[model samples]
Target: MVTSQSTESRPSLDYEAVIGLEVHAQLETESKMFCSCSSGYVNSPPNTHVCPVCLGMPGVLPVINRKAIEYTIMTGLALNCTIAEQTKFDRKNYPYPDLMKGYQISQFDQPLCSQGWLTIQVDGVDRKIRLNRVHLEEDTARLVHKDGPDGERYSQVDVNRSGTALMEVVGEPDLRSAEEARLYLVKLRTILQYLGVSTGNMEEGSFRCDANISIRPVGSQDLNTKVEVKNMNSFRAVYRALNYELERQIRALNEGERIVQETRGWVEAKGITVSQRSKEYANDYRFFPEPDLPPMVIDRAWVKEIRDRLPELPDARLARFISQYGLAPNDAVVLVNSKPMADFFEECVALTGDSPKVEPGQRARAVGTWMLGDFSKLLNAQGMEIRESKVSAEALSEMLGLIDNKTLSGKMAKGVFEEMFDTGKSPGRIVKEKGLLQMTDSTEISGAVAQALESNPDAVSDFLSGKEQALTFLVGQVMKATRGRANPAMVNSLLRKQLESRK
Candidate 1:
C-alpha cells in the first residue's frame, strides 16, 4: 500500500465521533426558482436580481424554472435516491426580514428524493451512509441588522438571494470518525460536480454544509443531546470542527455536565465551537401552504430520464483505478480525490502508445508519486490545479523517459521536471539548457571519485577497513566535486569497486 503521511495519528479517544451533515447547495439556474428574476445573486449589488414576484408584491405570481427542476432531479438521481414523482412545496412560515413572503417555499412532507446511500472509504475500508432525503426549496433573502433610532435594532432586507433555488441533502448519522466525515463530504461533492448540479464552491456560498455532532460513550445505546454546528466552510473545517467538538463533549460528559441540544457556530480561528441560538423545534417554524404557488406534479418517466443521465461517480472511478490500473487502495484514494489530476493521469496513459516503458501497475505508482510529491508541492505554492498547470501529461512522460533510461539521475531529473513545470518545455530541452543530464560516464565520475580518494586518505582507509558508512562519506565528497551532477547510484557502485580494490 502507498503510505499517506500526515502529522497526527488517529485519535484513540474514549468516545465515538457521531456526525451527520446537512448540505445546502444553491442551484446554478438561469432564473430564480419561483420568479422570473436572475438567480445569480452573488457578486451583484443588493436587490439587483430581485423582481416583483421575488419581492412578494401583492397580486404577483410565481413560476418554476424548468432547468432548475431538471438539475434537482439530476442531483437526486446521483445521490442514489428514489425520486418522488409527485412532490409539492409547503410554506415554512417563519416571520423574519429574510422572508419577504413570510414563508419559504420548501418541500417537507413530499421531497424530491428519499432513501439514498453513498459509500465512502474510512481507514481503508469502505462504509455506506444512508441519505435521509434531498429536497428543493427557495432561498431566503439577505438580512442586514444594524442599530436604528431609539436605541433599537432594525433589519434591512436584500431580495437578491430570495427565490434562488436550493437543494438540501440530509445524511444519516452513520459517520463514526473524523476521517469518515471528511470522506463523506468529498464523495458528496464529487457527485454534485459530476451531475453539474452545483459549483461545489464553499467559498462562494454555492455549496455549504452544517454538521450535527454529538458524542457518547463507546458502545453506548443512548444518544446524547446533539449540537448543530454552523459556519464551517471547507471539508477540512468540517472534519476539524467535529473532531474538536467531539473532544469537548466527551470532557463535559466525564465531568458530569449535561449536554444540551443547541446550535453552535464554528470558531475557525480558535478551532472550537461557540454557542449560537437554541436549536429550533418544528413548531417554532409555523408551517402553511403557499397561496401564490401551485403543487408540482412529476412522473415516473421524468425520474427515469434523470436516472439515465447520471454521470460516473467516485466509487466507480476508484474501482476502475484498482481493476484497470492496479493502483493500491491508498493510491486510488489520493488520485480520485482530485478529478483534474486523475484526468491528467488518464490522458498521459493514453498517450504512452503501444509498448509502454513499464507495466500498468508500476506506471500508476510512478504517476501517483509525481503528482503527490513534486507536482503537489508546486500546485500548493502557486494555488493552481492540475488542469490549469502549464505542464502536460506528455511532458511528464518524457521526463519519466529520461529517468527510466538512466539518462537523468533522480536528483537531476528533479531539476529537469521543475524547470519543465515552469517553462512547459520538453525534458530534453531543459536538460540540454542546464546540463543536468546524469554524468554516468565512468571517466568523469571516476575522476571525481579519484579526487575524493586523494583528498581523504583516512576516509579511503576507513572504507578499506570495512566502514560502510565511511564509503557514503567519500561518495558525498565526490558528489560535491561534481557539483551534484554525478549519478548517485553509479558513484556508489564505483566507490565500492575502488575501495574493494584497495588493501
Candidate 2:
C-alpha cells in the first residue's frame, strides 16, 4: 500500500533509481515444456491444445522437452552465462486459479545459467547490467476477466498457454534509469530473435517483463524497499511505468512517507501504478524438490556444441557493418538493431558490386541513407517491416546505381523511390514512364537557368549585389521550373556563368 503525506517543505535530495528486470521469453518449441501438447496455441481455441498432463489430471507424469532444454542452454550461452553442471526442478507451491497443478516446476537453488552480464548503451555510455540467473520455468494458464450480462463479473481460464516452456532472465539491480531499462529489454529481445529461440514479440505475450525498482539517495550503498511493476506489455509501457514508479517513490519519501514493498499493476490508460498485493518471497512459495522428476547433470560437451551453433548477434553485426562498410556508428546501430533491416542493408551493398564510378564506402553510405531515410519513413507510415516492403534490395541497389550515373537527380530519385515503394516498379521503368531523367544537356539547363533568372529578377539582382544566398534561391527556381529534372551541378554551373556574364 502506498500512502501520501502532507506537502511540507523539505530539502530535496538527489536520488538514483535501482532497477532489476525479470524477463520471461516463451521458447520456440513444437511441444510444451513437460507435456506433448502443441505449443502453437495462440490462435487456437481455449483449452483445445491441452492434454491430460497439461490439464493437471491425476496419475500423470511430465516429461522434459529436450529441445526446450537445448534452447534454454543456447540462450544462456548467447548471454555469456555459465552453464550449471547440475540442475533439477522444484515445485513452487502456490494457490492460484491459473496454476492447474497448484504448483509450478521451476529451478530454485541451481539454475541452468548464472552470473551473466549484458551491455547496454545510453547517451553514448555503455553500462553492463548483470544477470542473476537465466533459468527455465513452465508458464501457467491465462485468466480472462469479463463482465457478465447480468451485471456480474466472472473469469475464464484459458489453459492453452499452460505448460509452455518459459525462460526467465533475471537481472541484477544495475540499471539506474528507465531509459537504461528499456534499452536492456530491447537488447535482450534482439539477442533472442537472432538466436531464433523465440519470437520476442511483446504484443503476443511471447516476451514479458516485470521490473523491480527502488530509489535511494545518491552515493548510498544500502538498499531500500522495492516495488514490483507488472502488466506492461510493450517497451514503451515498461519505460513509462518505471519512470512513474520512480517519481512516485521519490515523492513519497520526500514528503516523509514510507515506500511499501508490494506488487503493483500498471494501468496504461491511467498512466499510473495501482497496488496489487504484497510482494511474495521464496519462503512464501515453499519451493522444494519435486519427487516426480529426477535430478540431471548437464554435459560440458553439449554446452560447447550449443555455443558453437550460436549465430552472429547484434553487437557483432554492428561492428562488422562499421568496419567493413565504413558506416557511421550511429547509422550502424540503427541498421543492426533490427536483424532483417541489417540483412537488407548488406544485401543491397552486395548487389551494388564493385563499380569504378562509385567507391564501396560511398555505395554503403548511399544504401544506409535510403534505408534509414525515405524507406524507413514509408515503412513506418504503413506499419510495415523492411521485409514486408514492396521494394527489394535489388531494386534499391539499382536506384542507387542510377543516382551514381547522373541519370536521376537526387530529388527525381526520391520521387522514383516513392513510386517504387508504392507500386513495386523498378527505378528504370518509373524514370522512363515519368520522363524523370536528369537534364544533363548543358543547352537545356542553360535555357532553364535563363528562364529562372528572367522570372526572379529580384533574386538575380540580390545575387549581383553580393548576397551569396540569393544564388541558392535562384537555383531552386530553376529546379522547380524543370520539375526537379535538371542536374544540380549543371544548373549551378550554368547559373554561375550566366551571372558572371551579367556582372
Cα lDDT tens digits, model 1, 1-503, are 11112224333345686789999998888888988888776888898998888898878878878888888888877777888867777888777778888878887888888989888876667788999999988888888888977889988888899989999999998888777888888888877876777878887778889988887657775666898999898888888888878877776765557888888899999998999865355446666666666777887887787778777777788899889888787777778777777888878766555645667667667777888889889988998878788889998877877777787877777778788789888998888888876888998898998889989999988878878899889989988888778889889998888877787
lDDT, candidate 2, at 481:
95
Q: What is the TM-score of each candidate against the true structure?
A: 0.86, 0.94
> Candidate 2, TM-score vs. the true structure?
0.94
User: Per-residue CA lDDT of candidate 2, range 99-211, in tens?
Assistant: 99999989999899999988998888888889999999899999999999998999999999999999999999999889899999999999998899999999989999999
lDDT scores of the candidates, listed in order:
0.81, 0.92
lDDT for 323 (candidate 2):
96
Best by TM-score: 2
Q: What overall lDDT, based on C-alpha atoms, would model 2 receive against the true structure?
A: 0.92
- Backbone atom clashes (below 3 Å) for every candidate: 0, 0
Where is model 1 more than 4 Å wrong at Cα? 1-17, 35-48, 142-159, 277-283, 289-292
10 residues in a row with least lDDT, candidate 2? 1-10
